[model samples]
Target: MQQESYSQDANISPNNYQLSTPTKEKKQNKTNQSTTIQSPNNNDFYSPKNVNPWKTPKSLLKSNQKQTTPDHSQQASPYGDRYIPLNVSRNLFNKQIQPFEIEEENAYEELLSENVLEIDENKHSSILNFNKQKPEKLQTNKQLENPKRKIDTLPIKVLDAPGLDDDFYQDILHWGKNNLIAIGLQRSVYLYSVDTSKVFQLTQRFNNQVNQIQYTSLQWNANGQILAMGSYDGQLKLWDYNKNAYTGTMNMSSKRISTISWANSNIFAYGSKDKTIHICDIRVPTYSVFQLHGHTQEVCGVTFDGNELQLASGGNDNRVFIWQLRGGNTYADSQYVSWEIKSHKAAIRALAWNPNSSGILATGGGNQDKTIKIHSSLTNTEINSVNCDSQVCKLRFSKIINELVSTHGYEKNQICLWQYPTMKKIHQLEGHSERVLYLSASPDESTILTGSGDETLKFWKIFPSQISNNMSSLLTMCEIR
Candidate 1:
């Protein structure tokens, strides 16, 4: 028997193998000539099951139908059960595989290039069509025209408030609607008439000097006929300026009264060191109508709303309380506190209600907090806050303008005027030698008066009077004659 050996080299030609019978060669030649190579459709080219092992797929052929080298690496068994080694048949497959030429257009690149060309054309066209011209000069006459009036921050009057206590918690000065300014100086209360420019002593006190019974707070009724004064002896005295006589006196629980606010013509509220607020009626001075008890420390500031139906009080406990005055037959059953706010980190002493808007209140904190908070009385929610950068000692809203004025201590030691709603600062008045402890507005809100520990009372002509064009003119014509 003869044994045949297969060559290990893949470059061996077909003739190197033993030749088959002449009849099989003729059949192979006929089959090779008659066979037509059909181009593969998308489905057949992507489907592995449609591939034929005996012949190269149409995807690997050229359009000219040229003869290609036999790829031994791609040649599989007749039954498609096995593949040839790639390393041994690399050269043969390299010659048969042609680099595919992609004639399909890239839609994305075409769209992007079109957009870029259009932008370039538009930009070039705009530049080409643009006309350059010299700018016209503004007329000198138009530039010189001014429409707004100028206001000066100078003080209209400065007077000596002798023996004025340099206390931060006590409110000793107030301006009445009848153009009367009352100030507590030691044991004496003096009334200065803005109309006459005359000062008169309203009361004399012998025990006030010996017992150190200094007046702490002063407030006038709505009609400006009755003046209420609170003394260090915990006594609230009402005096009639017309009659020049004391009308009544009510004793409070605390020895010192810090603040007093007139709720109405007949009712007034006073805050005391006893950490309570007493709402007393001048008609019935024997007993208070109602007593508010929420503050853990001394109540320093108290205010009434425009309608006199609501009251707000601030204390050294860093808390603010709002009370509703219910209309009923009995005083105790008529009023109750609505809400309590504990937002300040320091003592709260300055409080004011907006006269122009309902349910809006402003509160100021002491030296530590140095912030002013605006609140909504209806919902008991804080609307806004401003860091004044100094201790706020007093807050007053203007009746003639939509502005709020605040007196600050420590670093600033000045008065600031802020526009309402927007809270934008309009101006700052800096004339006080020390921290301003009291703030009051004139009857028409055209002037603001500030008292400081410097023991001097200064008046700021803040709002422009409608009757006069400037502050100097108004002061000369109205007060100075």
Candidate 2:
């Protein structure tokens, strides 16, 4: 229950992730994949049962052992009951947040366990929804503040923070804030902490959310820890965190920082409402990377090439401009290296880089233009664009599968999957009731987590086996490329 605090950066943990035992995919013979043990039946008087099976399943056993393995543990002690003793599941998550909550002392009671979320795997046509049981409400912090603030499940699983007031909310997103001991949010970034089951110490925030709040760009570093937030108010802030403390601060721009990204290392870049893109060093903000002109309107999103040598900027003007770092780490040599085919008809809302492919990119927009397009960073051509029902709210690339996942803002609130180069709709991830403002996936590509304005943060499992159009076709067509 103790909350830990840190005053500096060296002490930051990776946040909430821990490595599991290494697993190798080397191919093995089917026989090598498994083995069955047989037990003699007691009625037959010749069979001796192997009471415990290690990693072997009952279904896979030979018919001989089936008769002898069960019906005899009735009078046995607890250990004799085929019990799988529990071990703390510490290595289970790559990154997680302590459930954000609003405390109300004895006024609040626990929500029932029967309430569980159900998921439907298809995007464009499946119907899956949250079980609608309301939980006992909290009496403080939130306006749902009165004891009636109702929650329908375990209090630990509360989705949205209490909407009662600004202070009632947990504006913080700690990597390991709640339970695990050593982790949580340092700034706005997620980090690894020891145990999330316990409360985590939170760093004092950078001035709470201000009115006139609007941002054109927000980015997570490749590690997914640090976040650069640029606002329309012409102010840029960098939030550095772990479960411990705020590390440092840098002043980015005065032209209402339009777009921002961690180009590489401590190197950073920002496109502004000022109609120019500014490249600067994180360690030294005064050192300018030089500003370049291209967009006639506000630059909405910016992404850096894998080499950090190029920057891609997109805006409401319906264009994408690729800028190159003239020499070394400095952008003082910045120039419009290339441009993509006129991609969006409306303001671009999101742009993301593919970590595995240096020459690939994706961009999203804000309207019926809900289309997301993929571009060859190398050829600077439109490989293809996806058609969506609404504005593309958020975009993510899986480093593991090398596929793309995007959330269509108000359009569907559904998650859609796209294969790498083909840009074809693979499967639709349908869930979440509101606009998803933030979405993240594990570096290993296991799960997808999204934060929605519906006032709840929902975590989703992206099954590797989801039916893909191409995968389903192979069985019927028997065509191999």
Candidate 3:
């Protein structure tokens, strides 16, 4: 696996194979009994770079860029004594592509939510919304507070295989306090510790095709960290990451569990491909606590509001459902609670809500055009939209300054920042030549981290407040000149 650092185009779609030349090629046609030669603009699909034969790294990189368990075949911890068997996925797309690897195509092929409103529960539905505060402009002395790259933290290896397509497409990374995890094709889950800079595997085999992963840990019930994996197999598995052991696994449906989110720690909600959201109680250790069935299509993403309470789900049914954690004692006193909401145009892929804004929800558009749309979950309404580099693959809200972190589809690799109402481009976090897969914002909102097909995770600190001193000094120096 060769290691390379490349910049990403923030906004680009998966199907749109961007070659060196235009894809609009003219063709000879007889439309009205007249022969005409079409132009050459339709050549975007067959990227000339595909034929460059330079996809490999300049240097023949060795696979041992990062240290790992020597076997390479497979591994398990001491818990190996007990192995709970679950249904293995047999999908062609999932079985063929191995993890930590990639096989780029010829580069010719381009690939390509919600509800609301009104009175009667049966008739028409309405949404609630509100605009947000305008952000300040970019001050001087940007170098120190805002360094362009964090080379010290970026991964140096490249994982190659078929589904991985490009390394940049695999950049979206997730981390829990001490570890960073990359969610990839098949059941491929790679874990990296920020503390040690070492990487390892979480699951040898995926429940089916690994789509997304959400980490949850609540001190009230279990001290162990639980990972809710939404798989193409239409099942969800909860594994204790700290123990490196599988705790519980269930087949939610035959389709994928599009998204999973932790309500707190013991309580988590999962949206499914079958257009349903199931809220499970980790404490119960027996059955699902509650379920919301309103969306008619596949449920895409799920998130829990801050303050440790509400549940929000987005789906292909074009609807977003909101559920609150009521304190009243239920029949079983379980972690189940209940709520509802508005609709979307196409299927909803990823969603994020502002913890500081009292339910200000930012929904990123999926499907064809990746537009970032914002709405107030409290008062449902279309507030505004942010134009991304390409079709968006994922979007998240920063916990501190209320900023947003968004990752577009494979073709677009750069992560850009936008200040509030003014909608200004604050900074361009560059570096990641392949498709970005997973991304995460630190709890304090000062750092942004990402993982990609390049087989590594990188971290960047948001130079806003703490680094204000250096920026302030630069502004003064410019005035004297």
Most accurate candidate by TM-score? 1
- Which candidate achieves the best lDDT against the true structure? 1
The superposed Cα distance between candidate 2 and the true structure at residue 209, in angstroms, equals 12
- Cα-lDDT of candidate 2: 0.54
lDDT by residue for model 2 (194-227), tens: 2343333322335664554344345555554555
lDDT of 3 by residue, 1-481 (tens): 0011111553544323222211345332233122211112332112222222223322324443532222413323223336555545435536677576546743333221122222353655446434476667766797655455332233333333323323211222455544444444444555655557666776555466445443221111122276666566666666776677878877657765656667666887777667777778877866487666667887767787776667667766656666566664344422332334443455556677775578677776554545677776566566787667465556777654546777655457777666654556666666776655456754445666665566555667653434256655866888865
RMSD of each: 17.9, 32.4, 42.7
**What's the TM-score of each model vs. the native?**
0.65, 0.52, 0.54
Off by over 4 Å in 2: 1-158, 162-232, 239-248, 255-259, 285-287, 328-334, 463-481
TM-score of 1: 0.65
Worst 10-residue stretch by lDDT in candidate 3? 215-224
Local accuracy of candidate 1 as per-residue lDDT tens digits, 26-93:
44334333322222222232233323434555755644655445454643333332556687698786
